[model samples]
Target: MCRVPPLSPRTSPTISWKNCINESDPPNLQCGSIQVPVDYGKPHCEHFNLTFARIKTNGISCLGSLVYNPGGPGGAGSDVVFAHVLKGISVWSAELLAQYDLIGLDPRGTGLSNPMKCDPTIWNQRVSMTPQNEEEFNQLVENNKAFSESCRNLTGPIFDFMDTASAAKDMDMVRRALQEDKLNFLGQSYDSQLGSRYAGLFPQNIGRMVLDGITDVSLPGTAQLLIKSNTYESTLNEFFKWCNTTIQCALINQDAPGIFDKLIGTANTNPIPAPGCSPLSEHPCRSDATSEEILTEVQLGLIGFNGTVSFTGWPALSLGILEASKGNATLLSRPIITTPTSSDFSFLGVACFDCKATSISHIDLLLKRQMTSTLSPHTLGATQTYQAQAQCTGWAAPATNTNHALKPKKIAQLPELLLVNSLWDPSTSIVWANLLREQLLSARLVLRKGAGHTSYFAAGETSRAMDGFLLRGELPEQGTTFKS
Candidate 1:
């Protein structure tokens, strides 16, 4: 077991909880902030105030705090708690809700915390993430550099300190302030990396941790890009298959995949016009849907939620494709031009700080393009991977946390971890779960057989298993599978 120094009154930040629960909040919900060192490595340096919310247990018996992160690296933990958990409390398992107080901490540089900021004009520009030629690629590189500089200038040196390791340290400090000897964490998507790093740093402090929508930090940068590209291609194929059987599908009895490809080709040659789009002075709608916009919508649709609506079902995606094929771009362009908020900017800042390359190289670009083509040819290998590469090409901020791959040292007293994933998660991919399982010394893998991103939010068997583990310390049999 790892040793922790006794918490001194002078070292600890003040903890004061206020009744900031909104009308939408569930009973017993409370919110507060705690001041922490801006750079943990230099505790005497400047400090940042981190915000968090807690949903107190309803049962007579309390089982400490359960900290939650809804991925994005930039996703607001408090927002997730308020919107998904508290709002839909009925959907969650009563046992879990009654046992532990749900704690949501907006990590340093996200949400209620001192959020990272950048030039809105630079971020709002419609830049093609997937560049076709050398000139376009150069422009992308330049744009990324400019954006990175803007963030650095506005956010200051704190931009460099927003890495996952720093955030993980903040979590431990939160645990100390909560007066808990151990941490119970549920991290989704990119937050999985945060939780895993926390485990590596504080193994004995782990209580019952669940990492859903697994992200394998072990893979090399190039391999990571290929896996994501291939997974998205497979999920897109699954969408086509669903359309084949569902009569309500807009492209039913028609060649869905073929139509999608043809539409992309047409958009590549000439962007499809959206007549309904208002002038730029009035709204941010694009006059035409570029090929990049089409691909982006398809990618978002695969995640099962287009930003405007709750869930973008397969039928909705088919309808968008159908409209695009007929030379109308309204449906495809709507989600693309939706002006990004501060959270969106924070997402880029945190993500780039965590995983982006320090400097651009021609060899790296060529290798990425080749890998995307070879691994995910059907989808043209240009989605999130291409977007990340284009946007992070000339990222200037040096990574404060260099250890990307997490391998927790074996601690005999550490609690077994629970890992959950969908068999066909478009964003994270199932292979990541398999790889992560192997890396973690004590972990149980539960597979949710379905589409979409994370499984716990669905409140299905996978969710039940997760809740059981978090609430009662029950571990499902290794390699267990659940139908969503």
Candidate 2:
């Protein structure tokens, strides 16, 4: 197992990147950075940098590098590609790892790439608008508007450059530079979109590609919001059923049902207090933030259905709200996991760019649907509505193709692919997975009875299915469903 290496001075004469023909660094992968154009359209113009990492066998028997992408328009695939591989499952056969060179490419504006960054205060600000009355509702809109504008203003042209189409082109360029005959692709979550788009554009080049956490490849942004909303709302109900069996969930008031209500109620009224570091601010400290910052803090909770924050830290998030309510500012930021990288920005940039929706109408309809349903009331829609609208309306850069979004094309001749979905995936829910499965010519769907976004790496039986496919090129029996 590769232990975390100590921080060392980055040395000169980085490894020369090309298809590996011999065992260059026995069992240890080498990584390096390559400068790519900021705009593929204007390649001779401005240039930004992206880092690529890989591991493979030596002396010419190497088939080619198999490139992998982890989910998250913002997740670091470069980290996963070089160091990790289905860790919990360890299904990547030793032989597979030894023979096929594994490569991870950080898309522009992501890890090690020239990242597009914005002030953390910009995303952390709270919105004072509660919308209990008409004045508050208008203030809510204005609050969202201003927040969006700040993000846009702070993250200008770099935002537009992060789109998926450009990243797909970048992948092709990497393949060429590596001197590979063809590229093998593996993408999860939003990476599925990245991979599939590449397949659509360059299908003949496809080699051993696997797409997990499938998003609705056929739908545009508007329809995608609807699918995920309805899917997760139902999964939430199922989650509560499981929560009812557990003491942790049962100890709270009316069990899962009541806890859900209480959580939303508190969040809606108070928002969460974020006493954390902001990446965007130079001062790196702020004690007083506005309602917009509070809104941003609460917004994070609504975006995912992963494990709950610990009781100790949970209140810190809550305190972030309490302080914001009192007109005190606390900085908000993501818990430091990996070093802040340019790839992170590129991931978010491409996600926003790939989305086709120009207005908030789709989200507005989703919120309405959630409210009308008995299962999702006391849900976290108010903040998300404002969040999506804020990004799309105020901050999101103009779409490259106002008239075009990827439409699902029938690739009916493809072999049956494995589809994995988390039961309560806040972003891509099981329902959406089922919907996408229907369109596939041959596919098997597995529902992870767990609460998380992507199932393959999140943990569960789904990992077994992923391993089976990757190792033997096998697919689960059609309609396979597994519990966590």
User: Could you report the Cα RMSD, in angstroms, for every candidate shown?
Assistant: 4.0, 8.9
TM for candidate 1 is 0.90
Candidate 2 off by > 4 Å: 1-27, 56-63, 81-96, 128-157, 217-222, 248-254, 271-348, 360-375, 380-386, 401-416, 438-446, 449-451, 458-460
lDDT of 2 by residue, 1-484 (tens): 3232221212121235543224554355566565455676666566555667676555356656777767567665656653453233242445557657777767766664555665444344443423344454455555545644544565555556777777787777667666665667767777776765676566545556667776653555545555555554555565456444644332323454564455444544454444554544553544433333433344443333433211122234334433443434353433322233334334446555656434443344344444534434533333332234335443335556332233445354344556777766655666557775665555577766666556655445677677667656777776676775
lDDT (0 to 1) per candidate: 0.76, 0.54
The window of 10 residues in a row where model 2 has the poorest summed lDDT is 4-13
Clashes of each: 0, 33
**Local error of candidate 2 at 331, Å?**
15
Q: For residues 426-473, could you state the per-residue lDDT of candidate 1 as single tens digits?
A: 889888888877777688898988888788877778898898888888
